[model samples]
Target: MAASLIGRHFFIQSRNRRTLTLKSRLKYSSAVQAVSNEDVESLYPPVKPRFPPGNWTSMTEEEAWTRYEAMQEMTAVPTVKERLEKLTKKQMRAYRFPVNNKSVRVLEFQKNVTKSHLIKGLPTVYDSLQVDSLILEKIKPYIIEVLLLEKERLFRSRFRDIHRDSLILRNLIQTLLPLLYEHNTALRTSQVDEEVDIKGFWDRSGFKRVMWYDPEMERPKEFRIKYANDVRFQTAHVCDVSIRTENPLKEFLPIDDELCINEEFPVLEYHPKVFGTSKTDREKSQLTPGYNLGDPCEFGLVSFHNTVWLDYQRRKYGDAVTEEMRQGMGLTASFTWLLAQAYSQGFNSLLDVTYPMTTQTVLSDGQKMSFFAYQLNTIDMLKNNMANPRQNICWYTDETQLYEKIEDGKVIGFNDETCETLLKFLLMKPERRNINMKPTLPAESSDILSETEFISRNPLDLSTETN
Candidate 1:
């Protein structure tokens, strides 16, 4: 056994030595060598196995069809989910501009706005629509009958839990709209939507409407949709009553493309809504404008707004600031309604309107009403791209008094011009002016509407035709 063990040890050592000698010899022999082109060519025979050559001529019909299908598969549009994944961005916090955003109310940012400034902010032309005193007098007696009746209804309002101003405004609209129905047949066909959920976006580049945020107070926390991936004011101004019609009202004024093609516009330096801000709800953010250039929306003839948001504004900020806020409400509502309609029709901040859309706003506290006529000529005023020459037009007037006071149930000092103006707005018919509008609602593409539901919102009435 001892002899065997010693022999095995010697055998192991010899094997180790032999292995090392072979490894070293191999390492020494290994050297880099240049291969002749001839040797490399020999790796592949001239006649290789691919498709047996002359056996196949041109592609057959079946092969062509298969190839065409393959090409189509390769070039087809991405799936809806894939498109959404690529188009939608990470949820971002944004500024919301509610009709009565409390932050804006307290911040008093709108006090900086004026007629010319708003025109510049919107980059729109401005005009004043006023009746001559003599003309107002001539029609005063005829309109006074309805004015007195509206005043009576105004006094009869049961303010109850509702705010005084809101109630008065409601009563005034209820009493006055009927006169429109009696005067114009077109108005009778109009649809009235109350507290319509209005939402949209506008470039808040300060432009002519420059305003600074008060850093002393916490910044306002409101967010709206982004425009072409840019931060814009999400105008969610509420309309007390929106009168929708099949036809859009005629444009009050149209600027010639050549005349104002080189006109200068006001530039806003800062948008106050972005300052002292808070985090926003990313879930509500929607990408817009570029995709909605030609969609049709419900036409709004007249929108009524209430000064209820301006609570005690008269005393706290004084009449000047109060007036500013009032103008802001009317202006914001007017712009947002048109924008929302434009959005419905696929006209967004990224896409300007092909033709003008008109809407009238009545801002009131029951007694005094401020009227504004807005003609949205263009909406492509995004900060990065404002090359469009046409300016939007808004015709506005200071508060027109319906009456001075209600003395012992008798209306006193009723203004004839105010009544006349209000009636004219109500009488403003939706002339058969048609713009390219998508009959289907935006939400129809999703689960928001069914076939039956789509038809209801489908204003074009193509149901009878075969596809």
Candidate 2:
């Protein structure tokens, strides 16, 4: 074995030395030089392969079919098992089924299972799902119907409540109809001669006369002629009737003597209901300056007949009483006669007197009397002469006065002074006297200034002296 090994080693070494010598010889040879350039070019030439030209241009149809079949056989083909495996993978991915255990796999499984179940079980589940959907749909409509019915019930309840309240209010107002009618009648009657349109006096309805005791005249007199519809119109259509006594002695004998007996006898005591307790004796004292006292003849025997003619002409002509009447009766007599005529014409209220009292009278028996006379020209004179001429005046005890306008038996004007005077008069000794006076000031006098002296003054300096 040793000898064989030695021989093999020698042979291996000899072969390697020979191979190296050959490679060296080849590296240095000219053949290698020629091959370096032309060998690579010859192996891969730029030109395409050339073939010999033939008379046949193309293969016949059967030959071509055989060639195509052989070429197809040469291409790769997948087996049925391989194709099945690929299709299975694609299906698994598409349906998102659990190939591996994960949340993604669970969600995929749930979606596929639910969808498949819904589609496959459609026939059995359809009726149950439809019932649930129908329940959901009907719920909203049913709730809305219930709400609407409840709202209607609430609205009807409220309407009935308001209707009941209105009926109650109407009944209450009806109960007050009589008192309102009577009060309104008295007001209209008192305002007859104030240039008020008597046609509209009673709210399109005629008046019902109310009778009351007249202590002054000692007779049962008609206090007011009231209209039925006056309450609705808020209007007064009262005519105060004063009965003229044929026997003055019968009415005045007892009362006059008692009142005249003592200066402090409290003239208001006789008619405690008509006049309240006296605040001061000054109201019952002898007449003050600018006031008339005593009987009618003490000043002058001025008959109503004489003054009636002057007033008639003055009212008709709207001018001064005639000179004949003035000379025969004098201004005082003419005015007195005019007052009597006005009083006889149902203007017996002191407020209805058109003229101021000029003189007072004293009788031999110590009885005191005062007279208010009217002249035809008195209203014109007041309109033309008074510094702040107004439609009417309400005289109070302290010479405080209310200027007002009388229209349709309504005082349409009012002012601070007039309102104050009215309030004072309402609070006077004879509280019943306030019943005859209107509580509200006339609307016309509301914004009127009692004097124009401020207007005539210098605006810049507001001084009394003129520039």
Candidate 3:
């Protein structure tokens, strides 16, 4: 039994030894394993080179710099000093007022004259001046018949329906002017200037702004900008249509018209725009009345404003708003136009005009019409200049209905009074101003008007000879 046990032990020991040896052999084989042709081909593709360096240059510093200078000469690069000068000499900024804007409130407010916080009243002109008997009797009936005939023809036309107010106004002018022009010398000689650009800078107690980049200074506690975006600003108005006459209208009031020069009046503190935020502030400066002084038709006889632009106002606020909007339009259009004329004559916000200028204005929207007569008394409304006692004058009439509607070739509610008033406006003759009308232009006139020729000509003379 002992012998058998010893033999079994020896057999088990030998079996364990063989198992350990086999495990060691497998580990050694893995470490020294031979690579096959397939492994060699697939282990990894040969690594591709990237961003290879180019050959180094052997040029000296002087040679490199010379080459650079030559390239710069080819490109014509500016000098450092020239660049610095360009940076230092800042360009003048230009701000502009929109002629027609998206918002009625904005347009009305921007173009508002009465609410400008400027001087209000001047010597009032007699609006109820007697009309000539010839116009009242024979001319009135003829115009009425012509108007009726014209209305009938416009309504029956298939191509143009004449639904828009602008179209109606255009037609009215075309039909009426031709008839009146024959009888009226002023209307015949006076040419129409359409959409003439006028621009200038004047302070009607307008709010001031510090240049955005300017440093704060000791200012009045009340020195606040009218708008957040209100910067150095100016006025630029486009005269839609102006009747340019050969001679200026006679001054409505005598220069020595009695006035308590120190009479005080309340001023309107009104904001020009309702918009809360804006960034544009730079303003463009212009001083032209649509015509140079030497222009034969330099005098403005009448101004026509298209109230059809107020179509949006009527739709939003109802027809009642038309009167209020037009009243402001009449004031604004007349005021700006006269200012432009004054500016062109070398009068500015600082320098007042030597004589007053009278202009007639007609506002229409095809069916409705209103009339105004403006006499520009002063443009010097600056705070310091307000002591000058003269105030501007305006005479205006309410909107008159031309016709209600057209039905089946018969005109509905055709008004004769409106037609007569229109004829009166067209037939209104302009008399030459007996006074030295414009500022005393220098010998070398920017107006192209020779001082000698201007002074030598009689002030009452209607005939104007152009250079």
Candidate 4:
């Protein structure tokens, strides 16, 4: 064993010496020297094979195929799970908009071609309607009647719960009003600064009719579908343009002229049971203070409980649901559509000039209230105008509950989240630069049946279809 070990050590030493001698000889040899290919190949070669194997001459076809197969397995793309993990990690590190309140959640954030976050909600009602908007002219009176009846019912009910903790009403003043105004930056910031004359509007009996379509002689055929079998094609619609007018006398009742505290809006002597006690006498005129361009001629509190909201929550979170907990689920469609139409067609007339066409709807039922505001911006929906049908709005909406803390008949802890949200809504003014509304032909132009023209053209026809 000792002899064998000595022999192995001597062999290693001899190999090292030979390697050193070979390296020195290769380094010092003349470039012109003709060394045999076999001898040259014996020098220290590559530590490992090349990545793509060899040139065509060095690698056989079978060997190349084998290498390709091995590489295919090793360098395969990531699986779905692996990719998702990587994406999740990257997203977690990215900055996100801080949402302090758990109750308020942003469900969607859509961007348009300009990459602006002016997301318009779905137009559900508009798509379903086949008849021309002129139908609104006929049903205007009926709609007013129904709404007034509903309002009277709500007021007569005089539920104590609604007045004290009215979520719907609170949402209107705080959320909706600001949202609508801010959407059109001009109105939101009072940039136009146009002095509006309300004397005429106040003098009138408060019954006014505004035409949605222009009075033209030529009519365009806009029949959606004239099939006899489909009754859905003949349906007309009533928009939310007709809202209730305000009567200070009915609203601020119990406090007559003698007992009225505020001369401007007539404040009640004592807080009414139905409308609740005002935190201060200042509240009468303090609702939506900055909207000076147009007066709220059609302002009225409404009570509408949304059952759809309750059902949705019940399914989503298995939470306690109530009928009063109404959600304005599908109303967004009408709100967006009407506002777009108004801005595109009522720019000068229906906006704030002739009469304050601005309308406000506040619905409260459950523990919350939602608000919607409509203001006309531009009325150039005709062929010769820059009428935009997309994202051209100056409206506001909110669902945050109003009072945060109440103690001893006074709100002690006001909700910071709610207040902040309202402030944020106010801060968002509509910018003309951001308005990407393109010129689209008016939907009403499809029919040239103005009230006057339709009547003159078919004087003998007294049927509902003719006129």
Report the Cα RMSD per candidate: 17.7, 59.3, 28.8, 29.2
Q: Write candidate 3's Cα lDDT for 329-432 as tens digits.
A: 67767777777777655555545677878788887755678887777777755432244556666667877887787677556786877766766666667887
**Candidate 3: stretches off by over 4 Å:** 1-128, 132-171, 181-183, 198-200, 211-240, 255-263, 267-283, 319-321, 443-467
Q: Rate the local accuracy (lDDT) of all candidates.
A: 0.54, 0.24, 0.56, 0.28
- In angstroms, how far off is 33's CA in candidate 3? 99
lDDT: which candidate is best? 3
lDDT of 4 by residue, 1-467 (tens): 54456457768988999999988888886765765676556567667544343332333455445546543542242332222232223211111111110122221210111111121321222224243234324433332333233333445423444232233333233323443442333333232111111110000011122213332312233322222100000001212122222221011112122221222221123212122211222111111111221233222212122322344455665543221122222232223233222222222111212111233333333224354443322221111111222122223344545444333334444344433333332333222222212112233332122223423654585557654
Q: Which candidate achieves the best TM-score against the true structure? A: 3
Model 2 alpha-carbon drift over 4 Å, by segment: 1-189, 196-338, 341-415, 423-467
Per-residue lDDT of 130-197 in model 2, one digit per residue for the tens?
22333334333332333233323334423434233323223322332232333223222221111111
CA deviation > 4 Å runs, candidate 4: 1-158, 161-327, 333-399, 433-467
Off by over 4 Å in 1: 1-90, 101-164, 202-229, 255-263, 271-279, 286-297, 383-386, 434-467
Q: Provide the lDDT at 216 for model 3.
A: 40
Rank by lDDT (best first):
3, 1, 4, 2
lDDT of 1 by residue, 1-467 (tens): 54456457768988999999988877766484555676454655575344332222233444335434533442242332222233234454456655554343422343222112243221132214443465446555544444455445555444432355454555555655564465568777766766656766554433332122332332223211112323445555556677777688777655564422334554434455443434357554443321122223258778777775565656676776676567667666777777767755644443446777778888876676788877777765532223344565556788777878865556679877667677667666667755444322333332212223434554775667668
Q: Between candidates 2 and 4, name the one with more favorable lDDT.
A: 4
* Candidate 1 worst ten-residue window by lDDT: 114-123
